[model samples]
Target: MKTIGYQEVREKLLAGEEIAIVDLREEHIFAQNHPLFASNISLSRLEIEIYNRIPRLDTPIVIYDDGDGRVERAYTKLREYCYSNIAVLDGGVAAWQRDGGELFIDVNSASKAFGEFVEHHKGTPSLSAEELKAKIDAQENIVILDARRFDEYQTMSIPTGMSVPGAELVLRAPSLIKDENTQIIVNCAGRTRSIIGTQSLINANLPHEIFALRNGTIGWTLAGQPLEHGQQRSFSDLDTQIDEQVKQNAAQLAKRAGVKQINFIDLQNLQAQQDKTTYIFDVRTEQEYEAGHLPASRWVAGGQLVQETDHYAAVRGARIVLVDDQLVRAYMTGSWLAQMNWNVYVLADDFAQVLVETGGWKPATPQIDVDLFISPDELQQLSTTQNIVIWDFTTAANYKKGHIPHAQWVLKADVSKLIQQPAFTSLDAIVVTCGSSLLAQYAVPEIKTQLKSGQKVYILKGGNAAWAQAGLPLSQELELLSEEIDRYKRPYEGTDISKKAMQAYLDWEFGLVNQLKNDGTHGFFVI
Candidate 1:
C-alpha cells in the first residue's frame, strides 16, 4: 500500500472530493480539534465495533491520528476483512494541518453531536444536572440512571441516578424507566460511553425515549452540580434484564467475532478429522467447567475470554471452539473473537450427546486446581519483588493510561516475538497481566518454553489492577500514550516486513493523496 501526505489530502478535499476523514485519537484530543469532515473512533472502541459499523468488505477508507500509526493497523484490519482500498494519512493530523486543512475545535467533538442527535430524534429521553435537581426539588416523574461501573457511580452521582453500566443498559432500561411517561436519562463519567449507552438502546430498537445525560457527569461537575455518596441499591427486575442482555449480547458478539456454533453431529466430526488442528475451550466460569465439561477442553471463563484468548491460543492458525451451555456467554465471547478475526466456534444443543458418543479423549495433564489461582494482593507482592519481571500483556493504550510501576508491555498476540528481543533473553522471571489474571495464568507455560533453555517463571495473581488497588506505588507512563495504538510494527506474514513496515508506515503518512481519496463514512465519531 502507498502512503499519502497532508498537502495531498487537503488538495483532494479542496477539489470538492467526497471523503470520510477519520480521526483515530483519544476522545479528549479529538474533542479539541479535527478536520471538518472527520469523525472520532478511538482505538479501543474500534476493536469492538469495526465490523458492526462498517459491514461493507471493500469500503474505501482513510484513518489517521495525531501523527501516530493507528491508521496503519486499522488499514491492516480492513485488509483482513478483504478490504483492499484502505490507506493511512502520512504524518497523521499534523501532516493534514501542515497542508492547511481546516480544523474544528470544541470541548467535545463529533461524539457529542451524535449524542445530541440521539436526543433530537427518537424523542431520546434525557435529564440534565439542573433538570435532575429541579425534579429532585419538585418530586417530578424522572428517573436517573448512572450507566457506569457501580464503584464509579457510587463515588459520585446525581441524587437519584442508580448505577447501571453501559453493558446493562438494554436489560435494565424497561424496569428503570418503567412508566413510559416518566423521563429516563442515562449518564456516564464522560461522553463516549454515555453516548454509546444511549445509542445501544436506539440500536436495539428500545421503545422508551432514552437519552444520555449530555456530556455525562463531567459536564455535570463543570456545571457545579452536587453529588451524594454511599447509597446502596437492591437487585431489581432490571438486574434480570441486564443478565439476559449480557448473555444475548455475548452470543451475538461471539458470532460477529467469528466463533462458530457447531451442532452435536458436527462436534463429533471435529474429533474424527485428525488432520485439522483444533482446541476446545470451555468458556464458562471454572465451576461450570468442573461440574462436567468436554473431557479435555481448556478452561477460560467467558468474561475473561477476550483478554485471555491470545494467551491460550498462541498459534495463529489454530481453530478454537468455545463450549458453554449458556448460548449467551458463548455468543458474547465469540463476538469479540470474531472482530479480532479469530476462527472460533460455539457448541449446539446436542453438544453433550456429541461428547458422549465420541468416548472422550484423555487429558494431557491434570485439571488446574481452581483454588490455587493466586489472589490480586499476592500477585502485586510478587510483581514488586526485583526477581519477578511482569510482562504486562495489555493493550498499549490501557498500559499508558496507568500500570504497575515496573511492568513492561508485550502485545498479547505478539509475545513470541519478545523472545528474540535482547532484553527478554536476560529476564530471570516473567509475569503476565491483561484485563484480568486469566491471561497471566495461560502465559506462564508459554514464556518458560520461549526463554533461553531454562528460566524461573511466575505470574502476578490478579495482574496490575490488583497491584493498583493494593496501594502499591504506581507509575503513569504518559509518554507511551503517544505510540500508535493500531500498528504493532510487526513484519508482514512469512517474511520480515521491518523495512516494508516502515514503508507502509511512511506510505500511510506520505500517501495523504491516496487517503483523502479513500476516506468517507458519514456517521462516525469517537467517544
Candidate 2:
C-alpha cells in the first residue's frame, strides 16, 4: 500500500499540480474538519459518485479519514473499480494537524472562505439589515435582489426582494431598473452568494451603486426584521435582452481573470484528451436550460457552480468549460472560477446551432441489476408472511416525510453492521431500498456478503415511489437503525434552529478570511 505525507500533499497544492484529496468520512462528519481542497467522498458513496466526479481513473489521488481504517477498504474498492494511482494519507488527518495544516469546518469551506477573501481584497461595500429596512420604510427607490436559487428566495426573503439568482443579476438588472438613480442590493441566506453577486455588478462597472445586504437573511432574522415568506417576485426575462455593452464588459472582466475563450471544435479536442477530466457546465437559469442546451453539458446555475465547486468538480485541477447563450453569465462565472485557480473557459461558439438538445439536467445515474428486484406486491406479501427486514438508504428528510410502514432508515455503510446484531439474526430475508431503488441496488453485492446461509437480499422494485403510486399506505413513523448523518442541519436554514447556533455559524463565516491565510495553499486571485 502507498502512503502520502501531509507535506507532499501541501506541495502538490502549492505547485498547482493535478491531485484530488478525497475525505472518506460521511458528509456531516467531513464538515467537522478537513483540508481546504479535500472533497468529501464517503466510503459507501465512492462507487456511485466516482464515475461522474473524477472521470479520469488514473488521476493522482490521496484518500484520508480521521484516524480510521476505512481508507484501506476504500483503496481496495477503488482498485476493483479500476482506479489506479491511489494512495492513503499517512496517519490520516491527524498527521496533517501535527504538521500545522489547517483543517476547515463545514461544507463548501473553500468557496465560502474565498468569498470572504474576495470582499477583503476588493473592498466590496455593504449595508446592514437595519439600514436597508429604514430605507424601505422611508419609501426609497431600491431593488433588493436575492442572489440565491428561486427555491431559497421562496423560503424567506427581504420584503419586496426579487429572485435574480447569482449569475443572472447582470443579465436581468437592466430591465428591472428604470434609471441610474435606482440602487441595487444583493442578498442570499448568508453572506457569500450576496457578496459574490454584489461584486459581480461592481466589477462590470454597471452605472448603479451596488451594495451587498450585510449578513443577508440570517442577519435580517437576527435583527428582528421580518422576512417575507413565499414571495414570487423575480427578474422578468420577457422583452429583455442583454445589451452589447454589458457583454463587452463581462468579457473584459473574464479576460482580466485569465479566462480563456474556446470554440466548439476546441471543446471536442479537449474531450479527446484521455488524461484530463473536463466538466462542461451550462451556467444558465433552470427555465432557460430546460428550454434548450448544448449536448453533454450539465445545468448547474452559475452561482451554485461557484458556491459548491467541490460537489461539481472533485478533481481539483480539471478543466471546466462553461456554456451560455448570453455571454454575460458564462464570462462572469468564468471570471470568478478562474480567480479560484480553476482551469476555466467560456464557450465562444455563439450558441446558435449548439443548443439543439432540450430537457432538464440529468445525472449519470449508475446502472443497477434488474434481476435482483422484487415488485411491490412481492415485498408486501413477504413482509406479512415471513420474518423479514426492510432497510431504506434514502435521505433522512424523505424518510421522515413518508416511507414504507416497516422500513427502517439506515446508512448504507451501517447496513452490514446492523444485520450482525441480536435482533436481526435468523431473518428470512433482507430488503434494501432507496428513492427509486437504484441506490439500494448498488448495495446488493455487499449485503450478500453479510447474509447468513439461506438468507436472500432483494431490492423493492421502483422503491418507495412505486409503493405509493400503487395506492399503498405510507407512514411518517420513525424507525431509526442508524444515526442521521446524511445532511447537515444548516443553522441558517428552516425556522426551528436556535439563535445561538445561527450566531455561531455567522461567527465561523466571519473568520474564513483569516482561515484562507492560514491554509496557505489556496491559489486565489482577486482582481
Candidate 3:
C-alpha cells in the first residue's frame, strides 16, 4: 500500500496498462537522471498541474524522490486530495537503476527515444545538413518545411523554410505543391520533430520525395550553414480541405498503427469510464484550433504534443483522443501516438461539437484566493520593514535577471526546511512572488501552515512581472534560500548555445536508439 516495486511499474509500462511515473523533484535535477517514463511533476505545482495531467484519480500512479525526503510530502498531499491509487516508488530511483533500469539524462526521454527507434527500424530517409545546403545552393526544386511549432519556426529556421508543423503536411502540403517534381524537406530545431514529421509524410504515401533535414537546424548550423531569424513563412490555411485520397492514405497509416476511430457516442462512452483517464485534444494548428474546434478538448499542436508528451500528458497509459476538423490531421497524429504505446483515437467530425470557446489555448490553472493578494505598490509600502521576508519562487535565471528588492530565491518544496532557519523563523510576514504569481499563490496555503500564529503570508499580485511593469526598482542581488534547479536548459533551444553543446545534443540523440534497445520497456514500433 505504501510503495510499488520498480519491476511492477515496469511491467505496467511494458504491458501498456494505465500508469503514471511521477518524479517529484525540481525539473533540472530530474533532467540529470530518472526512469525513461518518469514525468517530473514537482510537489510545488502538483495541485495546480494534476487536474489535467493524471485526470483519473484512481489511475495507477507511482511517485519517487532521490533520497531527498520529498516523496513523503508528495504522498501526504496526494492523500489529502483523495487520490486513491497512488504509491511511492519502492527504494526510490536508485533501486530502479540498481535493478538494471536505465535513467535517461533528458526530458521527454521516452518520446525522443521512440523517435530514434522509429528512425532505426523504419529506415526513415534523411538528407544531411551539408546535402540540404548544396540543394539550396543550386536552387533545387524543393520546399523546406519547418515542422516545429509556429513560434519556434519564427525564432530561427533553415533558409527559405516554411512552417508546416506536424500533421499539417498531410493536411495542406498537397494543395501547396504545384507539381510532382518538388522535393520536401522537414526540419525541427533538432532531431525528433524533423524525424517524426518526415516519417508522417512518408507513411501517408506522399508522391513527393521527402527527407528529414538531418539533425535539423542544429545540424544546419554545425555544417556551417546560416539560419534565418524572424521568418514568418507559414502556409497553414483553415479553408483548405483535405483531398479524399489524402484522407484515405492518412487513415490507412492510422489503421496500420492500430489507432481507433471514434464517433461522438464512442467518445462519450470512453469519457464516462470512471476507471479510465481520457484526454481529449485538438491536435490541429493554433490557427485552426482558434478559428473553430470541438468544445471541451485541450489544444496542443500535433507535432508538439508528440514531441513533448510528458509535458502535455503525464499519464502514460491513459486513452488519448485527438481531434481535427480536417480529420486527416488527427489520423496522422493519432497514428504516431498509437505507436508510442498510447491508446489513441482519431475522432470523427460528425459530432455537433460546436466551436463554443473560440480563442487561443486556455490552460486550466491553479485557483488563486484574491484575499491573499497584495499589489506591488503595497509590497513597496512594506519594503522598509526588516520584518518582511520576501521569498521568490521564480526560476534562478529570472531571479538573477531581476526580482523584488531583498527577495530571497526559494524552491517551493524547500519552504518547510527554509522557515526553520534562524533568518526566516523571526520574520513578521512572508511574501511569496514568482513571474506571474500563479506559482506563488499555490505556495501561499502551504506556507501558511509553517507560519507562527501571529505571522502572515501573502502573494505579490501579478508577481515580479507586475513589479517591473509598475516601474518599481528591482534588486539584482541574489539571496539564496535553496539551490536553483527549477529549469533544465536544453542544448538545442535558444540562440545562445555554443557549437559544442549543439553537437553534444545531436550526439546524445544519435545514441538514443541503442539506449532504447537496452532499456526495452518502451513498446514503440513504426508502421
Candidate 4:
C-alpha cells in the first residue's frame, strides 16, 4: 500500500483511470460532496460488506477520509486482505481545494454547479418553483416527484407532488411518469437524494432527461413556495384488496417453506400454559423498533435472523414466533428458520399490537421448507435497487476477508445486539447470506418474526464464496470483528467451533422457556 497525494488522484480521475474512489464516512457526510465516481462504504460496516459487494482482488481502489484516522485503519485492513492496489487521498478533499482545484458545489457545498449543469446540458431536465407553480396553475404536463419517505410526503409537500421513496424509485418510476415526454422533477427534504435520484435515472438510460428539483423542498420553501400539510390519504380500496392478497400470498409462501401460522391469543395461552421455553423474535429493523415493537421481543432483522439464531435463541427445541407487518418477511424468514429444527410460526392476528405490547411470542407450529434457494447474482441484482440489509452469518474472519458490499456486520457476540439500533429497524428489505446458505436457511422462520411492519426478507442465493467466484467487487482486507472476537483469538487459539456443538447448543437453549416463565419473562427469548 502507498499513500498518494490529492493531485495524483485528481489527475488519475481526469485521465479516466478505472479507479474506485471509496468514501469511508458516515452516510450523511458522504452524501455531501463525494466525487462523481466515488461510492459509499462506511468503514464501520466494512467487515460484513466487503465480500458480497466487492469480491475482486485486482480492482484499483483509493479511499479518502475527512482527515480522520479511519483512512489509516482502512489502509491496514485492505492490505491485510491482500487487495492488489490501494492508496489514500493525500490531504483529503480540503487538500484538493488548497491545490486550487475547483470544487463541485453540490447542495451541501452551496455552489451553483447544479444550476450550471442544467444550463449547459440544455437536455438536463429541470423545473423551477416558478415553473412548477405556473404548470400547477395551468394544469399542464408535469409530475412532481417527492422522493422522500411516505411519512414525510404526508407531512408536507407541493399539492401536486407524489410520494416516491428513493429505493422504490426504480420499481415505481414507470408508474409515476407515464409519457416519455412528461417532464419529471425529483425532490427530497434536501438535495442529496434528489440529485442521486435524477442521476440514477440518467444512469439507467431513461429517455427523459432528469433533473433534481434544485435543493428539494427546502429550496422550494426558501423560494416562497407555499407548502401543503396534512396530506395523509388512505391506501386505495384496491390497496385493501392488495393487502389481503399479500396476506394470502404470504400464507402460501409460509406453507411452501413449511412455516405454520398461529393467532396472538393462542400464542399468549401457550406462553401461559406451556412449560417449555419458547423464543420470540421481532424481525423489524432497528428504526422500526424505536417507532414501536413487541415488548421483551429480541430484535433481529428478518434477513439476519437465520444467521444469528444461535446468538439469541440457539436451542433447536425453542418455540420461535415470527412477527412482521405483513407475512412477507415472516414467511420468508420462517422458511429459512424452519430448517434449523425449531418450532416456528407466523403470527396471523394482532400483529401490530403484539409487536407494540409484548414485543413478540414463540409459535407452536413447526416449519419445513421443501423448495427454497437463492443465487448470489440474484441477491446482487436485488441489492442494486433496494435498501437491502444483508447479513453474512459466517465466521468473522471470512467476513473480514470478503463479504457482501455495504452489509452491516454482527459477529457471534455482537449478533445479539443487531436489533438494538435505529438504522437496523428502518430497513425496507433484508437478505442473509453466509459462506454457505445453510445457516441462513435454517434460521429464517424465527428471524422473520422480528421484522419491522413492512420489510421484505430474503436469503442470498449464493453465499460469499459464490459471490467471490462471480467476479464482483470484493474488498482485499481483513479486520478483527470486535474486541471479543479479537480477544478470544490468542495467537494459538483456533477459529473452528464444531458444527455439532453449534447445533446442540441451539437445541439445548430451549431450556430458557421454563426459566423465562418462572421469572415472569414468558415472552422473552434469547435472540
Question: Which parts of model 2 are misplaced by more than 4 Å?
Answer: 236-239, 350-352, 365-370
Instruction: Rank candidates, lDDT, best first.
Output: 2, 3, 4, 1
Query: How does candidate 1 score on lDDT?
Result: 0.54
Give TM per candidate.
Answer: 0.43, 0.96, 0.92, 0.36
How well does candidate 2 match the true structure, expressed as C-alpha RMSD?
Answer: 1.7
Where does candidate 4 stray beyond 4 Å? 27-40, 66-68, 103-119, 123-131, 134-155, 164-216, 229-527
Per-residue lDDT of 437 in model 2: 80
lDDT (CA) per prediction: 0.54, 0.87, 0.84, 0.55
The regions of model 3 sitting more than 4 angstroms off are 236-241, 290-295, 359-370, 384-386, 397-406, 465-480
Top-lDDT structure, candidate number? 2
Model 1: lowest-lDDT 10 consecutive positions: 488-497
> Compared to the true structure, candidate 1 yields what TM-score?
0.43
How much is 235 displaced in model 2, in angstroms? 2.4
lDDT of 1 by residue, 1-527 (tens): 65777666555544534334556665556645576455565543454334323333344456776654556656665565565556677767666666666454432222333334333343545556576567678987766777655666666676777876554455556666657687667776655456556655655545556667765655565567766676555223233444564455555644444567787667668856644445677765455566677765766654334433433443333456777675654654454454434566788775565333232223232123233345556665655564656667666767777887767766443454555567777665666666565544544544556767555666566667777777766677532312343333222111223443434432332333233334332222211
What are the per-residue Cα lDDT tens digits for candidate 3 across 1-527? Answer: 47888788888888878888999998999998899888899986776677678877788889988878888888887777768888888888789988888879989888898889889998989999989989999999999988888888888999999988887877888876658999999999989998998898888888989999989989888888889999878885334656889899998889889999988788889988898889999987677678877766888888888888988788878889998877887898899899998889988855445555678766565455547678998988886764898989888988999888889998889887777777767788998889988777777777777788888888898999999999999888889978778888888887888999998888898899888877888888777
Cα-lDDT of candidate 4: 0.55
| lDDT tens digits, residue span 1-527, model 4 | 47777667656644434455676765456645554335555565454444323434455677887875678777776776666678787777777557654433121221122222222333435566676677789976667776555666777777777765553343345556658787677876544456545644553345565667765565566567777776753111112222344345445645755678888887777566434445567665455555666665656665345533433442224467876664655665665456434568877786556656533332221233624455778877777777767766665656777777776544332333454467768777767667765555444543465777887667766667778888878763443333322212211012233434333332322232332223221121111
- How many pairs of residues collide in model 2? 0
